[model samples]
Target: MRLYFFSGLTTSCNTLKFDSLKLHNETSNHVTSNNITDESYWYYKNSVDGLWRRWDISVNSETNVAAWKMKWLNQEPKNILGVIVYLTSVRELPQLNISLLSLRQNLFKPRPIVIFHEGDFNNVNVQLALATTLGTNIPISFEHIRFPTKISIKSKIGDLRLGYNHMCKFFAIMLPYHPLISSTFTFYLRLDYHSYLLGPPLTYDLFDHMQINQFQYAFLMVSTDELKFVRELWVLFQEFLNDSCIKPSSAVKKTQITAATGLYSQAVVFNNFEVSNGSLWRNEPRIHAWLRKVDNAQGIYMYRWGDAPIRTLAVTQFLDDNQVVKFRDIGYFHRREYTCSSRMHSCSIPSYHRLASHIVYREGCHP
Candidate 1:
């Protein structure tokens, strides 16, 4: 799957490593040959002797002077992950140091590591001229959120090409009786909004741009340039409350998700095929199995889908709760909320995405 992170180093991502089990983008430097098993390429294995590794990259016409290069040499835990920067000028290298060393963090979580950019760096004089000329836009990206803390995310709200920054409400397709007392339609709308932002910019000739205008207004109270537009948009949307956002007494709208832990020892097939954690043997082999693979969790969404038969996450991160501070950064998003009632015990909030979709939740059947 393919996804675009709204935040993170501006560089396109390629791999998600975990002890010999690696995922690398097809176009990345380390994955070009398409011979993942060849194991004899230049970019094959730079990581430790055992820990999983994957490297990725592709060609682009992005930089010339003061550019940045990533040399993640798979060194010791915290030995060598530094930016080899090409700045426009050394006159203010000290200022750029903040951008240079932001990646050198000591946090237990993976904070957003990055390098700021400007003009030519190799030449001290040119570097200074470029920095001053493009001072305002130098940082490239900023964070309304932090990372590697209680939160598991990092991102850069780059130019519009990254994705649209807007608000979307999550609607309870099942619960229409009490709209306000259910999971806010925020998440569902968000995926649509992502389609907008990540798709491409719209070009209109004004007179016939009424549709665009209404669309923009629906997302933001007032619109200006991209940056200011999102600020206004955020406030306008937050007011509408949902069962998850504001916990209050109200006519219940939707089912809740209950968390149960245990073990599974058997399997049953709709037809004659087996579906286990390891085999994602396309839904047709059996039936729909998309949502089934997503472990239940709040604030979840899918990021990428592509030719590799694997997944590539572009922007798979969401705010944790009210603060909009801590968030869960993942390739796809899902959440499970426990609901208690007058039943024998408790049940989890139920959600269905396309009908007849294969339903697979972690549990053991009663003997």
Candidate 2:
């Protein structure tokens, strides 16, 4: 089975460092028998041949595409489940390409990757170049989803003006339904372009655990008490639910939103669940309308309204907190912040040595 790995990045010297990690590792076009050991992690295969499969089916005739999908479906693995969904804007395409290159060299198996972007057809060509240059064997596809530059959500902090980065990240929630994304993929992994997987190849068994629990989303749990980010998130989330005609969870209703800065007070984390998709239809339109309403509104524009809180809240609307697991063992690193331990060290690439030092010596809030 050949799985395609996709990325959302571009070709630039400034961002070439991101793909430098690929240089340290060998690039193989096929997985030999020796490489497929008991511990080897395998990804879904793409029986549908050709680079044309990389583009969204919406661009082609629906009847023709449907016939192709039906044929592909027959060859899909029985255990074929989810995909790693990566998002990036046109400008960040170069960086994402670097990430994909590194992923190609590091992992034991290739993953079915969908690069959900906020760009035009030209950007898709750039991604294709990077994928080919990286010499990845997996099937890769790109989907261009329009993101709003302006939004209407009222923020207590100040005027909220979201950029491409913010919109692309949050827009991932809808990628599972995109025409380019196959229904065979039940879970979608939303990772940052800068986030590098250093160690412990994620096995399919772990995905089975995730799928069994009905988790639609997952994230690395970070401290939000200091900034009162989660509290504000709850208040805003409640308003979002009300506007969307969905009911807010009890954890959201009972939580108190206080104006407290960094102090000794411990924050409340909402760990609550029931599985429901009643509000899925309101996902895109509500966010779009709200952004349009607030994009040009007058207020302070010093600080930006981040997507983390909103994204976290969005997952809650679909699944309970128990379904959204926080995995620290993934050995993730974004910038200087990382999850580095003795176990992770064994499987990590050479770059971990330099990056690990910065994390251990530097004083930064790593959540």
Candidate 3:
């Protein structure tokens, strides 16, 4: 029965009035106008494996993708694990050198999880009976070569490390690509992030009564958010501390390095800004239409950005400067003429936009 409570004046002492149940030690948090830490803390501590699973099925021969819900789990918390890889483009398997699963994650390291699909998409009216059957087990693992940042799904021959997000520092296990095909083949995916506490090795197997007591109380407090609703809960927490008799709790918790700045906030801001201002979808209004979550899936939690789904998912840019790749006629995708070379990460995304009057990926795929 771990319990945690807080208010405007809650201190370190009474914070443990019920510390006997805590699994860790005292936690101190504060708010800042542009604060990213609080949200980061929540992401690393709770958002991993946080959303409820929604099962969706499809048939036929088309491509569909989804980014579903992600939230916190009051119960067991753990980090997220996923993988994405392109199976085949032809109706049958090609004689490739190695299975996508066997491919080395990067030139130097090995990826943990692996996923692979069999077959290709030649029969449009055809059910991907065999291919999809193999897809269910594909664990999401991005090639490690995409270091510092970058995650790409599908070994389909391009460097795709960029992911999308509409961040307010709030994250959940989001299944971004929900593949469905009824005459349509779709992609199904899940997103999540969790603490490193429940990780491998020597963890919280200690004997601390006071910390346990505090955790017993905090655990009962629903979410750190709910505690804020009650008036003077912080004050009560402080009063408990003034007693001096109460000892501090010792509860172990784990969070991502980003937790200090806000879980993926900076990254989200960077990626979204790239997408919002770049070309990822076909049409703005059409993209908005696609943004609506169906079947009460995971990602949709009440609209933000504009409260107008139309605007938030609106298409901003449609230029691909890399190699010319197109998602149907929606638009084209290409690498930027001027991107961060191994030697220089000089040009920012916006700056990349500046190099060429318009992206010329339709112009080519490599330098």
Candidate 4:
């Protein structure tokens, strides 16, 4: 089996190929691995002695600039617009099936789907079930991801679990740098395991919509982050602004500052149902610097700083209002938060459920 490692230094973002590892199947309780036995694999392992050490030290060094590089494989994708990605596990397979079914039924056109897991579905039964669910027509690929480990020794904030912090970092930092994803899709939409489309079938291809409009990012909803998790995040952000001298846009200035206290607001872009241009996150130099700064601070592992607020701050600080868009006319639901289009009757959720302080509604939708 081939093992791939991404260098922590931005200057050496090329793929580090280690091809001699062996694949192994484990019992249901153990996380499977393609190259667990290889001693060289320690360099890429998710531990203090592995990639985390390199990631921590390199990002903090002023001489090292961290960036994601695109490395294409031999088999190139053909005319692909975008990919629908789900970071899921064995326990979430049932919900994943439902989500994929919803995409098949509701999307105007089928897009390739990628399922990422932490080496839990290395068996035949799980593979067969996924193939059966999406069927033979749509292109689907399963990729194994390393389990996320603690980057800081500080105590974690709140009651968030390790997996939750992993999800936040994965979406925020790791996903775009993925080799296949970067080489294949122009954009990607991230859907949580519990997220579902509950509207009349999408009338347009979302990828085309963004491409034609030159939009860099789109989100289904906007909400506020918990103050406890993000209390120091703004301070860190302010420090970045001071050091980098990047002026905040009018959109950011208007939304983030409170009227009475003149302090940072807790507003964030809900990213559970987010569609983003791949290059915006992958190729942008300033964005890479900002991400490196945050990672070095250990904000993700220590304070439970979520990708939603991190990306929210990035979009506001770096992008103009025109580059970012709010997606309406698509009924969507995830966890307790949901949005229903007034023009669509396919929403299964009750109308009263639509009213929430965090959700921002537009078009035919009302509070």
Which candidate gets the maximum TM-score versus the true structure?
4
Q: Can you give the TM-score per candidate against the true fold? A: 0.18, 0.53, 0.20, 0.75
Candidate 4: clashing pairs of residues: none
Candidate No. with top lDDT:
4
Instruction: Give candidate 4's error at residue 230 in angstroms.
Output: 0.8
Models sorted by TM-score, best on top: 4, 2, 3, 1
Model 3 lDDT-worst window of ten: 215-224
Q: Model 2: what TM-score?
A: 0.53
Q: 1 or 4: which has the higher lDDT?
A: 4
C-alpha RMSD by candidate, in order: 24.3, 16.4, 22.2, 11.1
For candidate 4, write residues 1-367 as lDDT tens digits.
Answer: 0111100111111342212211122111222243454321111222112222112212212222222222112222344778788888989877778777778777877677777776676565776677667666566666655653433346466555767877888888767655434545778999988777876788888888888888888877776788988868999988876666565556566667777897888878788988998767645655766777887787887888899888888877767556767776787777666777656653566343344443434431223
Q: After superposition, how far is residue 73 of candidate 1 from its true place, in Å?
A: 12
lDDT of 3 at 354: 41
Candidate 4: lDDT of 363? 38
Q: Give the per-residue lDDT of model 3 (tens digit) for 211-318.
A: 232211000001012221222322322233244343222110011113465321111111211111111221122221233321122122221121112211121111
Q: After superposition, how far is residue 244 of candidate 3 from its true place, in Å?
A: 24
